[model samples]
Target: MKKMVYASLLFIFFSTLFSLADTTVLKPSKEEEIRDTIVVHGMVLHGRVTGIGPQRLSFKLRYSDGTNRIAYKDIDSIYTKYNYRISFKRMDIEGRIVGIEENKQYLKILEGNHERTVKIADIDNFIMAVSEDDSFENVVRNKFPYTKGSIHAGLEVENGINRKNTADVRLNLKRKVAEHETRFFLNYNFETTQTADEPKVQNKDELIAAATYKNYFENEQFFFASLAAEYDRPRQIQQRWLPSVGYGYKFTFDKAFWLEPAVGLAYATTQYTDIQYQDDQFTAAALRLSGEYLMDDVIYINTLIIDGNIMYYPSLTAAEEDWIMRSNLGFSIPLFDFLSVKFIIDYTNDSNPDPEVGNNKTTSSLLFGFDF
Candidate 1:
C-alpha cells in the first residue's frame, strides 16, 4: 500500500510540471503567429500598421514586397492581432477587434466569449495595445521605405471660334521610415492657342522637378538637403538647377498642424535659350518656410487641407539683383475615399530674368487627383 501511494504522488507531480511547460511554450508561439489582416479592393493582406495619416494608413505588408498606404475610406475591413482600447464620446471599451462592418459604420469586437458592436460615429478613436516586445516604434523602425503619393492631372480643349489645348500634370510623393523623411515633386504643363485666322502659337511649355530629404533627431531638429531642376520655353530658360543644404526645427502644435522653418546655403545655375543672355551661376543664403493644416473632421464641406511652402534665395556671390524666390499654396478637399479636388497657386520671382520676360510669374490650376 505504501508503494502504490508513493507512485501516485510522483505521477501527479510530473504531470503538473509537464502541463506548465507546455503552457509556457505555447503562449509565445501563438502570439508570434498573430498578424493583422486588412481587406481593401477585394484583396486580403496580412501586415503590421506602421503609421496613420489623416486620410491614409501606412502598412508594412507580410509576404509582400514593401510598405504602402491605403485610404481609410477604401478599406473594406480590418482585423487586429492585439487588443485595442476604443474610446467613444462617452465611454471606452477594451477588446480584441474583430473588424469594421456594415459599410464601416460599426466596429465589431470580441470580449472574451462575448461580442459587442459599436457605432463608429459615436467613437472618437481607438488604438492597439502593443506588448513591450512589439512596440509601435519597433514596428515602424523595421519597415523601411514606407511611402505615399498622389498624381494630379487636368486637360482642356476648345474649338469653334478659337482653338486651344492645354495639359497639366503634377505629382507629389512622400516617404518616411525610421529617422529619415523625403519628398518629391514634379509638374509639367503644355498649352497651344490659336484664333480663327491667326497661326497656332505655343503659349506655355514648362517642367519642374524637386526633391528634399531630411534626417530627424530626438529633439525635433533635422538636417536637410534639397534640389530642384526646371525649364520653361516661354520664359526662355533652357535649364536651371538649385541645390541647398540646411538645418530646421519642427514645431508641432497639435496632431493636425505643424511648421518647419529652415535656413541654408544654396547654389543656383541657369542657362538661357537666347544667345544674347549669358548663362549664369551664383550662390545665396536659402530661406524656407513650410507648414500644413489638416482638419480631423469635416470642418467645412469636407475635411479641408492646406499646405504650402516658400523659398527665398538671396544672392551672396552675385549682384544683389540676382536673388530668386519661389512659393506655392494648395487647398484641397477630400472626395469619395482616396480622391481629392485641389486648387493650387504657384509663384516665382527672379531679379534677373531673360529678355522680354517679366521678373515675376504666377500660375494657378484646379486639379483632381487620387492618392496611392
Candidate 2:
C-alpha cells in the first residue's frame, strides 16, 4: 500500500510541474520521512511546501528534483501540517477554531492571504504555509525574501551634565527563506568625559559586529549559529572574537509584540592593548533574553518603539571568573517624514577587568537623525 501511494504521487506531480530556478535546499542533517498530499486540477500529489504567499502556493513531490507552483485557480484542496488552509463557504467547511469575531460576524483561521468568508459557519479540510524544508538559498530566492522586517538602521548622540559627551550608531539586516533567517548587526560608539576631580579628560571607543543564522520549526522553536567581533578601549581590550551555536524560542503576544529566549556556547578570545592584562582567551556559555514592542502613532501623533537585549554568562569552575552580563534598552520616535529622535541605555559588567579599570561601564545617549 505504501509503495502504491508513493508511486501514484510521483506520477501525478512529475508529469506536470516545472523546476524553480535560483532555488536550492540543503540536505537534512537528520532523516525524518514526511510528505503532504495536494489536490489540484483533479490530480492528487504528495510533496513538501517550498513557499507560500497571498494567492500562490508552491511545492515539490517527495523524491523529486525541484519545486513548482500550484496556481491558485487550479488548486482544489490542500492538506499539510504547517501551512494549512481550509475551505469554508455556503458550500461547506471548519477548523480547530483559534479565533472568532463578534462585531465583524466572521472568524480568522490560517495566516496570510488565503482567508475566506463563511457566508455561514463552514470549513473544508486544511492547507499549510510550509513544511519541513530548510534551504537558506531557496528561502532567499523565493517569497520569503521580500516579506516584512528585513532592514533597519539608526544613530544617536548626546552631551549632558549627568552623562559624558557620546555618540552611537547601529545597523541591522536580515535575509530569510521560509523558516530559516540570517541576521547581521554592526555597532560603534565613542564617549568623552571630564570630571571635577580629574585634571585631564578620558575618552573610550567600542566597536562590535555580529552575524547569526536561525532555522525555525513549529511552536517557535529554532536552532542557530553566531559569529561576533568587538573592540573595547577602556578595558584595554584591543580585539575580541566569539563564535557560538545554540537554540532559541520566540513568544508572540500579538502583531506588534514578541520576545525570544536564547542560549549558546561560545569560544572567546581577547587582546588587551594598554592595560596590564595583556591577552585572555577562554570558553564560556551565553544566555540571552530579547524583546521588541511597537506602538503606532501613540498619543495620536508619533509612533513609538522600544526594544531590549540582556545577556549573561555564569562561572562553571573554581579557576574561572566567567560571570559576565550586558544589557541594552532603546526608545525611538519619529518627529517627521525624514527625522527622528532616540534614547538608549547600554550597560556591561565583567567579573574580571584590568586593575586600572572599573568592573562596570554605562553609557546613555539621546540623539536625533534622519530616517530612510
Candidate 3:
C-alpha cells in the first residue's frame, strides 16, 4: 500500500511539473516590429529617423556628422523600426469610412475584421487628423500659412551711360491674412538726354504709388478698394490722389489665366503746377477690368508675366470736367532667381486737363529693382 501511495504521489508531482512547463512556454510576440535599414541609391544608411518629408529624409548617424539628406527618389526601399507602445489581442479595425447603411445601422469602412456599426454622427471631426509624418510644404500650405519675400535687381545694357542715361525703378509688395489681401506698388522713371546745345538735360521725371486692399470670398467674388497717389513733372501735376471703393468678380479658368471685373466710385484730387488751375477735386464713377497671363514655360525666358488694367471714369458732372480714363500695361521678366526686369506703360486721359497740359498723356518706364 505504501508503494502504491508513493507511486501515486510521484505521478501527481510529474503532472504538476508538466503543467508549469506548459504555462511558462513563450510564443512569438504579437507586436509587429521592423529594424531600421534605409537604402538610398545602393547605399545603406543606419540612423534614427528625425524627419521624413516628401522631398527628403533627415536622419542622424551614431556620431555627430550633422543631419544627412537623402533624396526620396534615390531611396530604393525603407525598413522602419516599429517600436509599438501597445499591443492588442485582436487585429485593429482602423480604416476610413466608405459609407453607412442607415437601414441596417451599420458603418461600412474600407478595413476592419469586426462589425463596425458606429454612428457617423458621433464623429467630431471631418478631416483626417494630421499625421506626424506630413511634409514641411504640406504643413506650410495647409495647417499654417507662411510669408516669404524676395528682392530682384535687373538692368538694361542697350546704350552706354554716356549716350543715353536712363534708369527705371520699380517695387511690388503684397500681404495676405486669411482671405484678405493687401498690395503696394511703386514705380519711378528718370532720364537725362543729351542734345547739341544741352548736355544731359533732365527730360523725364515721374512717380506712381498705390495701395490696394481686397477681401475675397470662396466663390470668387470680392469686395475691393484702393488708394492711389501720383506725380509727374512734365504733366504739370504736383500731386494726384485717387481713392475708390468697389466690388469685383474673379474669373479663373486655369492657373495661367484669370480676370477681374470691378466697378466703383472714385474721388480724385489733383494739385497742378500749371498757373491756370492749382487744385481740383471731383467724384466720378469708375469701371475696371484687369487680367493676368503667365508665360513662364518659354524656352528663352526664365519667366514672363503679363498683366494689364483699364480704369474708365465717366462724366459725373454736367460740365463734364471730372471725366478721366487711366490704364496700365506691365511686364515682369525674371533673369535669375531673385532678379527681374520690369517694363510698364501708363496712360491717362483727362477731359478737363490743366491749361498748359494736354488732354492725354502716355508714360513708359523700364525699371530694375531688388526683392528681398
Candidate 4:
C-alpha cells in the first residue's frame, strides 16, 4: 500500500513538471510577437521598413515581389513593433512609429507607454531596427552608409580595308541621404584606325565629367546646382565648362516613372585645341532648359528600365546661332540580381563647330555592368 501511494505521488510530480515545461515551450518571444505593418491607400502591407526619407518611405514587402517606395503623403499609416533609432536635428529617440499624420506633417511614437509627437521636418535620419544579437561592431560593418555606383565598359574591333578599334568606359555614382542628393558621372572613349597605306592613328579621344547636387524641400520642389566639364579631341574642343543653378519640381506619375523639368540661367565657355579655331572660343550667358526622366518595369514587364535626360543651352550673350544641345538615353535589362545589359545613345550638337569637325556627333554603345 505504501509503494502504491509513493508511485502515485511520483507520477503526479512528474506530470506537473512536464506540463510546466510544455507551457514554457509554447510561449512566443517578443521578436516573434512583433511585426512591422504599413497601410497605404487602404492596402495593408506586412513588411520590414528599410528606410524613411523626408518625402518617401522604403519598405521591404513581406508578401510582395518588389520593394515599395512611396511618398509620405501617400502612406496612410505605419506601425513598427520593434524599436527603431530615429535621429532629429538636436536629439535622437528610440521608439516605434505608432502613427503618421500626413496632413499635419508629424509622427506619433510610442516609448514605454508614453506617446510623443515629432515634426517631420525635424527628422535628420532614420536607421533600421537592431537585432538582439547585433553588436555595435556588426551594426557598423553591416549597416554603414554606402553609395550606389555602376561601371560599364564596351569594346569593338573591326578588320577590313581599315582596321578599327573602339572602346569606352562609363561610371555613375549616386547617394541620397535625407534631404540631400548628389550624383557624379564620368565617361571616356577612345578609337583608333589603321589603313593599309598608312600606320594606325588615334581618331577619337573624349572625356566628360559632371557633378550635381540637390536640396529637396516640400511639395517636390528643390534647389539644384550642377557643373560639367568636357574634352573632345576629335572635335578640337580642348575643354568646355558648363555651370548652372535652378529651381526644379518633380512630378511623380504613379510608382513607375517621374519627370523633372528645370529652367535656369547658365554660363558656358569653350577653349579650342587648334590655333585656327581660337575664334570659336567664347564665354556667354545662356538659358538652360533641361528635362530628366526615369521609368522602371516598363509597361509592368518588370525587367526593362529606361532613363534619359536632355539639356538645351541657348546662348544669350553669344550669337543667336551658337546654341548647344546634348541628349542621352539608356535602356537596361537585368540579367541577374546585380548585373544588367545596357544600351546607350549620346548625341551632341553645336551650332558653331570647328570647320574641320562637323556640327553633330552621335555615339552608341552596348555595355555590360553590375551595380553596387
Candidate 5:
C-alpha cells in the first residue's frame, strides 16, 4: 500500500507539469488577432455618427483590417446603434475626427470642398442603417471663394458745455478684400450742433478713406496697421485735410481675452474762406490702450480703454501759438460679426486763454460703426 501511494503522488505531479507546459504554448484564435491592412468592405458595427446634411450623412466606422486596425468614413447604409437605417452619398474617405465626447460625435473631412468638420448627434429617427455614395475627400476639394460688401447707418448724439450740442447721421461702406485679414473702409460722418453763444452750427462732415492690413502672428499676438486720409469740413471753422498713420498690437489670452496698445500720428492743415482764425498747420499724436474680454465669438465685454492726443500748431503766430489736449474713455460692444456700438466720454483742454471761451470742456457721445 505504501508503494502504491508513492506511485500515485508521482503521477499527479507529472500531470500538473504537463498541463502547465500546454497552457504556455497555446496561440490566439483567428478572430482574436489584430489587423493592420486596410479593408474595403466590412459590416458596420457600433460607432458614432458625427455629421448630417440635407443629402448626406457622415460617421466613423471602426473595424479590423486582417493584420491590425483601420478607421474610415463609413458612408454606407449601416444600422446605427439605436436601430435606424442610414445611408451616405460617399464612403471610405480619409479625414481627422475632432471633438469627440460622451454622447457627442464630430468628424472633419480633410479633403475636397467640405473641409470643415461638423458635429451631429441630435437626429432622433435614424439610429441604425446602411447606405453609400461618394467620398468626403472628393467633396472638400471643390469649394469656391467669394467677396462680400455691407453698409452701416446710425444716429449719434453729443453734448458738451463749451461746445455745441450735436445730432448726426452716419453712413459707411466696407468691402472685404481677403476673407478676414484685409479690408477697405470708407466713412462719411455729418453732424449739426447748436450753442448758446454761437450761431446755429450746421454741416460738419468728415470724409475718411482708409486701408488696413492684418497679421495673424505667433504667440496669440495680432498686429494691424492702417493709413487714412480725411477731409474735415466744419461749419464754424476752416475745412481741414489730414493724413494719418496708425498701428495696433494685441496679445490674446486663450481665445477670449486680449490687451491692445496702439499709437497714431496725424499731419493736418486747414484751408480758410474768411480767415477769422488763422489757417494753421499742425501735427497731432495719439495713444490708445485697451483691454477686451470676449464673452463669446460674437460678444465682447470691454474691460478698460484710455485714449489721449496732443495737437501742436506749428504755423501759428507768436501770440496765437497754442496746443490742445484731448482724452477719451469708452466701451464698445459688438452687435454682429461686423457691427459694433460704442459709448464714449471725452475731455478737452487748451493752453491758450480765449477771453470768451473756457479752456476745458467735457463731452459725451454715442456712436455705432461697422468693420469689414
Candidate 6:
C-alpha cells in the first residue's frame, strides 16, 4: 500500500508540471486569422501624450478598428507633450495580420508605431473635412432666394353720405429671378367711394380703379427700375385721369441698410360732370427717397419716404401742385421653409389738405405670402 501511494504522488507531480508547460505554449486558432486584418479610414481619433520632451512621444490611442476588440497602443513619435486633435480625411489606415491565438487575432500597424492588434473587419473610412473655403462654397450653393406673390381682400369703410362700406380687393403677382436681383410685378385694385358732397353731384357711388406694372433690377452695389401706371379716380372735388413713368436707384451699405431715390412723371386730365372742365394735360413729376434696415434671417424694418408731385391741365387753364410724405414700419416673419408673413403700418402726410379729405392717413395690413 505504501508503494502504491508513493507512485501515485510521483504521477501527480509530473502531470502538473506538464500542464503548466502546455499553457505557456498555447496560441489562438486559425479561425481568428481573418480578424487580424482591419482597414480604417476617415476617422478622427484623439490621444494623450504619455512621455514628453526632445526625445519621442509615447501616445496611447484608444480606438476601434471596425472590430469587437478595443485597441490601445503607445505610438513613439517626435512630438511635444501637449494634447493634440488630429483628423483623418479620405485616407485609409491598414493593419497587417500577425497572429491568432485562443480565438483572438493580433494586428500590427505598418506606419504608426506603438500600435496594437485589432480585429480585421472593424475599420472605418470616410471622415469629414474642415476648411473655411469649403464653408463659403456651401453658403453660395445654399443661399435663400427671394420671390413671392399674394392676393388680399378687405373691407374699406369711409365717412361719407353717398358711400357705405365697400369691399376692397387687390391682386398682386410678382416673380423674382436672377438671385433676387431682378423682379417683375403686376397689380390691380378696385374700390368704391361716395361722390363729392355738393348739390350738383350726380353719381352717389363712384368707382376708383388703378393698375401698375413695374420691373426692378439690383446688384450688390445698386438697384435700377422702370415703372408704368394708369388711374381713374375722383378725389375731393375733381375727377382725374393719370398715367405715369418712373426710374430709381438704390445704394447699399454694410449689407444691411439701403437708400433708394426715385423720380417719376405723370400726365393728368381734370373733368367735372359729363363736360370736361379741364381739357389741358399737365405733366407731373416727383422725387422719392427711402431707407431700410434689415434684421437677421427674415425680419426687417424701414422708415423714410418723401414725394413731390406737380400737375397741369391745359383745357382747365389751371395748375396744381402737391407734396406728400410717408413712412412705413414693418417686419417679415418666416412661417415655413417657403412661406412668410409680412406686417406693415403706413403713415402719410400731404402738404395740401382738403378739409373734406383727410390730410394724414394711417393704415395697417398683414400679408401672407410665399418665397421661391
Ranking by TM-score: 1, 4, 3, 2, 5, 6
TM-scores for all predictions: 0.65, 0.54, 0.56, 0.64, 0.40, 0.37
Angstrom error of the Cα, residue 258, model 2: value is: 0.9
Candidate 2 lDDT tens digits, 315-367: 44522465567788988775643356778898987755676676778877776
lDDT of 3 by residue, 160-191 (tens): 44455566666677655546778787767666
lDDT-wise, the better of 3 and 6 is 3
Q: What digit string (tens of lDDT, one per residue) describes model 1 on residues 294-328?
A: 86446445367899999999889664678878899
How many clashes (backbone atoms < 3 Å, residues ≥3 apart in a chain or on different chains) does model 2 have? 11
Q: Among these predicted structures, which one has the highest TM-score?
A: 1
Candidate 5 Cα outliers beyond 4 Å, as residue runs: 1-110, 113-167, 170-225, 229-237, 244-248, 263-266, 272-274, 282-286, 296-372
The lDDT leader among the candidates is: 1
- Stretches of candidate 4 exceeding 4 Å from the true structure: 1-146, 157-162, 279-301
lDDT of 6 by residue, 46-131 (tens): 43222111111123343422212122222211222221212122224322222333233222333344444434222211111122
How far is 221's C-alpha from truth in model 6 (Å)? 8.0
Against the true structure, candidate 3 reaches a TM-score of 0.56
Better candidate by TM-score, 4 or 6:
4
Q: What's the CA error at residue 89 for candidate 6, in Å?
A: 35
Clash-forming residue pairs, model 4: none
lDDT of 6: 0.39
lDDT of 2: 0.61
| Local accuracy of candidate 5 as per-residue lDDT tens digits, 29-61 | 543342111223554343444334322343343
**Which residue ranges in model 1 land beyond 4 Å of their true spot?**
1-51, 54-145
